[model samples]
Target chain A: MPAALQATLEFLRAYAGPLIASLVIVAVLPLIAGYVVLVERKVMADMQARLGPMRVGPHGLLQPIADAVKLLLKEDIIPEKADFWIFWLAPLVSVTAAMLSMAALAFGPAFQIARDINVGILFVVGISSLGIFGIVLGGWASNSHYSLIGALRSAAQLVSYETAAGMALVSGLLLGGSLQIRTIVEEQARQGVWFIFLAPVAFFIYMVASIAETNRAPFDLPEAESELVAGYMTEYSGFRWSLYFLAEYANMIVVASVATTLFLGGWMRPFASVRWMGWVDFLPPLLALGVAGYCVYRAPRQPVPVQKLVMLGVAGLCALVALLLAVPLLLPAAFFLKAGIHGAFWFVAKVGAYIFVFMWLRFTLPRYRFDQLMRLGWYFLIPVSIVNVMALGVGLVLHWQYRVNLWLALGGTTLLTLLIALWLVWADRKREAEALQARGGPGTPAADSYAG
Target chain B: MLDKVIFYVFGGIAVVSAALVVTRRNAVHSAVFLITALLATAGIFLQLRAEFLFVVQIILYVGGIMVLFVFVIMLVNLDVALQQIQFSRQKWVALLVTLALAGQVGAMLWWAGQPGKKTLPLPVSVAAPAEKLPANAEAVAHSLFGPYLLPFEIASLLLLVAMIGAVVMAKKKV
Candidate 1:
């Protein structure tokens, strides 16, 4: 072979693992995002007393695939006045940033693409933040008022919440004492407790800030449908629109994974450090088997033969997974396999639970006005998170420097933070009342309500 | 070989994007190019193994500052500005200044490449072995909070003052 070809082969050989992993992620993520959307629709339907998309396939299992096909086959459109180059590139930027952030995330002990990056979690945050450019650029390129306003709202919302989010993450990082995703999880294992219980306030702040950061409902003033027609996405259609949708879902997963690794103990089973909780290791396989059994039980109730066959197929698939999970536990020689597989199961489960909570909130809560969203981020969340960080720091100092009981220190600090948060809320309410009085009366409504 | 290739690619991107940032007629396009340049610079930091700096550059510069830049650019009426003269009247002066800076940089590069010449003045103790060097974030934290704590605090105070000035300026009734 020629020298250049030989060199290329050598590089490929060295990077084959990450290369394959990257390929898998790029291929699978869009499908995963689609399923997530389907789940969200189903959840919303359940909450709202309706069935979601049952016409597509068995229980709408294939709706995402159908949607994907439709999106791919749709006509691509661009406005006459649009900036052609940026319009073409914007969605690609969004999706690329969203997916690139995943490179640093540790999905399991054995599954990480860019392993051993010193600034792992920060890398994810920083790269994901870069996706804002996509929104801003797309909005600008569309040459539409709605798109520009939506993009601007998004930019402001993201910038405001990111500060609180970063501060909350700092509180967690102080406890973990590391930036590497793997190290953070390992620290939780070493501590015999998750960071959530120790720094509950930080976790709460992170949860709220993350929702706002991802532009989910209640905090989703950026693309508020009744206001801006799909926000920054007003001009996009077909595959390009799908790319933006995929990026949003991918961002959800990324934030969920970050929360899991930092506060929910990444891939560890519940009570992971407790020696008496060894039985939890068996729970994964048993849970899969339980799912399989439930599927089998429901298979006969399907109204159509095709639905029944699909249900049976799902059961079989679950059964195979259960077997796969069980075999490694039974065999001592496959220790790494057990750890890797079980770790992945728990990690994905926690991430799913997080996403479910996100969907639940989306269905339950009313969307906040843009001003209210900004107030909550800047006035409420920011101050509380800052105070929480300081209190947590003090608690850490007490625990390490003054020989205070760990639980006592953390619990005391948490209570103190809560009290401070209460005081802040009361003060804000008072200020709002005063401002209302200054505006003449409460009946008149706030002047800035529709400012955005 | 891989590291050199990666560095050159990123360096080339940074330079090209930076040039485009100044040359773009549209303000939004200029902001986008600036973001590209910032991202490319962050890549260079990653290549140099200054991991904390890499993320900080992305988070603070590309993410925070560039977003604000784009926001301001969008809020402004760009059509009127775009229709204005693209170049300033200081062409000769600008070229002269650019040439002088280029000459200074070229001279420095030549001096560094000279045989048996010490490129940088440094204490022997500052050059630690790679194995003994602290993690990037730890080293930064140590310096920021340890010996440089006073300076860091002062800088934060400076930022606070600037922030107050901005708020005061933006407030209608203040």
Candidate 2:
């Protein structure tokens, strides 16, 4: 090869691993997000006392694939007045921004695709926020009143919640003493406690703001079907719409991954530092085994041979995964394999738990009015997070200056925040009661429910 | 070679989009172009190995400020604005401001490309070798929380004042 060509090839060789890893992540994430959608539907169905999508495959296992095909085959439309180029570009922007945010995420110690950027957390935050551009632009280009209003609401809501979420992240960053996701996880491992135990309020704020950021229910004013008629997505259809859907779920996974990495200890088994709890390392395979067992249990109960065959195949797949997980445990000498297996397993489990919580919240909470959502973000979450950040800062100062124990310092701050939270709740309730009395009726519009 | 290519590509995008921002007939299109320009600038910042500035530029400018600009554009009576003369009322004032800005930008660029000054290569510094430079978030935090703390506080107070002023101006009862 020519000298410059040789250098270029060498550069490609060096970066090919990360390049391939990122490509895999981009490919796999949408599929994962698809399954997440199915899981969300199933969980929501279970909550609402209904069977959801059972006919697609054995217990709706193939539902996501079916949905994918339908979306892919549907006609892509652009309204006559719509800005055609921007209309086409919007969903691409949304999905690209969301996927790009994942570049900074350390999936686990072993599974991370990108080199750990120093400004990892901020990179994720910045790129993820760029997705709002797609929403605003899509709505604008659609040339519809509902789309415009939805995008405007989304823009406002995203900006407002971001402040709280950023503050919440700062608190965890303070505890970790680093911006790198891996460093944050390692900090939790060293301390023998998840940051969630120390910064519960920060975690709470993050969870709420993340939901709002993702435009999930209770804060989903942008897409309030009853109000905004699918909101910014009003004009979208077919593959274009699926791209937005993929972006939403991918963003969900990103936020959940962040929460896991920052607050819950990225890939550490609970009680990781303790000697007796070493067995927790085996939990991944055990869980896989349990899943396989459940598949086996359900297999014979299927009405048809095809369903039974599918169930059996699922059970076999789960068993294979369990075997793979266990193989690492047996290879005591292979540190890389062990770490990769356990790290990915624990990391994914934590993400799954967070996603489940997201689904639970979505089904349980009623949608908030736009004003109420704004009030919660600004008055409640923002102020609370600010206080949390300040108190944590003070605690860190005390610990550094006076040689106070880290746990003691964090505990004191947590307790102080709890007291402040109590006062805030009380004050908010009092204001609501007064407003309710002024309105003068139980069934009146905008009446405060808790007051009565 | 790759470094030169990237610099030119993004720089080209920044210039073209900035021009579009000013020249677009529709206000919304102008805002969108402005965003494109801002993002291109942010990409340039990243290439410069100013990761802190890159993220801050994206988050604060492209994400926050541009959204506000878009919001205002959407809210305004764009139809009426479009119907009005493109170079109405403040043509001379606008020209004067643009000239001034162009002059300033020219001076900055001229200074930047001076022979004695080293132009940092854009592409090969994914891992920037400016170890001596205070370049990361820690450096930023230290500066904000330490020596420059007073100025930071003052800046925040200024923002608070602006916010309160806006609220007061908006409230008819007030």
Candidate 3:
């Protein structure tokens, strides 16, 4: 072979594992994002006491596929005065950047795409932030007032929340003593405790900031339909609009994965170090079996023959997966397969749980006004996270240099952070009350009343 | 060989995008090119195995500063700016200044290429094995927290002062 060609082949051979993993992830992410939307709709429907999208398939199981087909076939439109090139390119940029961040995600012990990337978390953060460009450009290129304002608002919100999020991540980084996702996970495993226990405040901050970071509700002022009319996506239609939707859900998964790796011990089964908790290894297969059982239970209730067949197929698929998951347990000698299957199951479960919280919050909380969102990010989240970082630093220093007991140091620091947070909240409320008083009375409209 | 190819590719992109940044008529287009140039530079940083610098370049420069630039571009009505003269009346003076700058750079390069002359203190060449060396972020952390601690603290202090100044300036009747 020619030297360059030989080099290329050798490079590919060396990176074949990650290349295949990345390709699989990129190909499947949109479909996975589609399912996440279905789950969100179902959860929202349950919250609102309604059956969501039931007409599409058996219990709306095929709704996402139907939606995808509809989106693909719908007419694509570009406004007359729009910046044509940017309008076309924005969704592509958004989806590409979001997918690129998945490269840094260590999916499981055995399923990682990019192994041992030293700046793994940073890589994810940087690439994901680049997705903001897609939102901003999409909004601007639309040549509409709503889009422009929405994009600007998104930019501001992202920049503010990012500070808090970065600080929160730093606390986890301190506990893990590394930024590489694999090492962080291994650290938690070795230590026999997740970082969340060491830094609950940090984890709390991360939960809030990451929700804002992904533009989820309360913080989804960027796309607040009541205000900006779908915000940056107002001008987008059909496949282009679906691209933005895909990017949002993909970003959510990215953040959840990061949170799982850093705070929830990545793919480690709960109570991993405890001999008594070895039974937890069976949880994944059992969960899959339960899902299959449920699918089977629902199969007969389908009104149409086609829907009944589809439900039966779904149950069969779930059963097949359950069987495969159970195979590792049956063959104890297959350590690699066991680790891979169990690790992926736990990792995905944790991510699902995190995303479920996101959906729950979305259904429960009303949207924040833009000003209120900024206040929460800047005044509350930022300062509290900064204090969390400082407290963590002090605890680590005390433990290392002064020989303080580690848990005691950490506990003291957590207590201090809680006190600081309480004081900040009290002070903010007091200031708000004083401002309200200055505005004359309870009935009098203040300058910044956030009420609808 | 692969590293060299990546470096050249990213370097070419950096150069082209930088030129586009300066030459674009629309301020928004200029800002977009500026982002491209910054991203290209970050790619070069990654090629150099300065992963810390690469991520920092993206996060601090492209993500943060360029976002600010884009905001300013959007806030200022681009239509009015586009209608105005882009180049100043001192085009001759600007041309003269550009020529002088280019001459100075060329002279420096010529002198540096001489056999007997000492070269500029570039970063050490990529000779060390990747695994043997500490990761870039770790090395950077150790240095910043160790020998460079004073300078880092001073830089942070300066940033704090600048932040306070900005707050004061932003406030009404401050």
Candidate 4:
């Protein structure tokens, strides 16, 4: 080998895990995340008097991989007038933006790709914000009129939502007292309380922000072909087009993963009775790594079987997570039982539930207008999230004076939340009734929408 | 040996791609070349063992910001760069200014260079330590919040301000 080649090999050898891990993650994360998409679709299908994607597998398990192959082999076209190079670079930018955040996500107690970054949560925000560029460029480079308008809409829309999202994430970071992902997870493990209980308002804001960030369902106005002719992708075809789809779905996965790590106690189970089992504290970390590895290696070749294995593994991991959380309350036996019931089972169950909701909204909701989307993000989510952050801060300061128990604090927040929800619902119904009275009669539909 | 391999491979590519970024006739082509240059610089960061910076450089710079640059180049809708945008009689003036900028950078770097040590100032490891990671992380956390906390907080606030400014600039106020 030449001298430079020899040196390059050594460098690769030295930093093997991260370099290897990044490459591996780039390849498999899309596959894993896309399966969640299929699961979402199927779950939604069953929810509304129908079955979905059952023919692909015994229960449509292999649908994602099947979809992947279809995308890969699909026809790709390029417009003559398009700025071809920029159009090509757009999807790579989107996909790469989503994947790069993994460096800061330390998965296990010791199995982190890199460690000790002081500004991790901030780094994630900074880097993820860059996704705006991809959307803008993708829209513009297509050289179609629709694309430019769509890209413009996306640029404004994303910027507004991202601020709200960043503030929502800040609420989570404040509860942890440190920015590191692993430490945050361990805090939840030690306290046996997830941030969701403490920061329910933040959690709701984040879920909404994440949906918009991923450009999923009703928030996907930028790509709604009914108006903008495929939005930014009107001029793209072939592998290039598929790249954009992959990147979009991959970003959704990334957002979900962030949600998991931040508010879902990461790989820290809600129950960890296994730690008392002598070397059981190690299982949550192991399960995390094992699933990531197994999905990467086995998912491509035998996707149906691999997905089944992964799903089962997630259920088990959920139980473990629950057990880990309950160790404070339950001792070793309680830990194991909860791991079986709460920790390992809960993650898979929640992820499954979230995916179902994702698909449900996908099928049922009408796409928002670009202006409406922006208004929702800025006017609604941002203010609410800011209020939540201030409330959490107030609660934290008052903790010492009040001698407030964690459960009591949680109960108080929960009750406050219930009251707010009820009021919002009543207010919405009143507004609807008033609008109906103004329009003509209660039975008459609005002129603009048939569904009404 | 590894250092030399990285230097020759990525550094060479970086230099070539950067040259192409300016020299290419097509604006879109120039953007692609810039992406290549950015990727190679990320490789250099990887070789230097700043994994966090390396990832951010690619994710934020190569993937995020550069894509916007390409978008603007494409959306501005030029069949090609007009004579005004390309080489002109003022080309010599532009070239001279670029050279002056380079010289200034070179002089500053030369002043900062420590010949005593081989590499620039940064923590070194092929990867993070398998053990002692939490200690390393804690030290980093302490350093960030301890001495560098002011600058770190300022950077985040600056970003938030910039974000707000961008929204203001882009939005059509009704």
The residue ranges of model 3 lying beyond 4 angstroms of the native Cα positions read A1-7, A443-452, B89-125
Arrange candidates, best lDDT first: 1, 3, 2, 4
> Could you give the C-alpha RMSD of every candidate to the true structure, in order shown?
3.7, 3.7, 3.2, 8.5
Give native contacts recovered, as a fraction, per prediction.
0.81, 0.70, 0.53, 0.23
* Candidate 4 chain A least-lDDT 10 residues: A336-345
User: lDDT: which candidate is best?
Assistant: 1
A1-452: candidate 3 lDDT, tens digit per residue: 58779779878988898898889998899899999999999999999999898988899988999999999999999999999988998899899999999998877788877676788999998889899999999999999999998899999989999999999999999999887988999999999999899999999999999999888997898898999999999999999999999999999999999999999999998999999989987877888899999999988888999999999899899999999889989886765698788888889999999999999999999999888888888879999999999999999999999999989999999999999999999988888888778876684666446767
TM-score of each: 0.94, 0.91, 0.94, 0.69
DockQ for candidate 1, C-alpha atoms: 0.72
C-alpha lDDT of all candidate models, in order: 0.91, 0.88, 0.90, 0.68
- What's the distance in Å from true for residue A78, model 3? 0.8
Instruction: State the displacement of the C-alpha of residue A382, model 3, in Å, after optimal TM-score superposition.
Output: 0.8
Locate the minimum summed-lDDT window of 10 residues in model 1 chain B.
Answer: B121-130
> How many clashes in each structure?
0, 0, 0, 31
lDDT of 1 at A416: 95
Taking all chains together, the TM-score of candidate 3 against the true structure is: 0.94
After the best TM-score superposition of candidate 3, give how far the Cα of residue A305 lies from its true spot, in angstroms.
Answer: 1.9
| Model 2, span A1-452: residue lDDT tens | 48668667776876798888899998898899999999999999999999898987799998999999999999988999998878888888899999999998887787676564677888898899999989988998999999999999999999899999999999999999988777888899998999998899999999999999999987888999998889999989999999999999999999999999999999888888999988887878888899999999999998878999999999999999999889878876665687777888888989999999999988999999888888788778888999999999999999999999988998998899889888887888788888877877574756666765
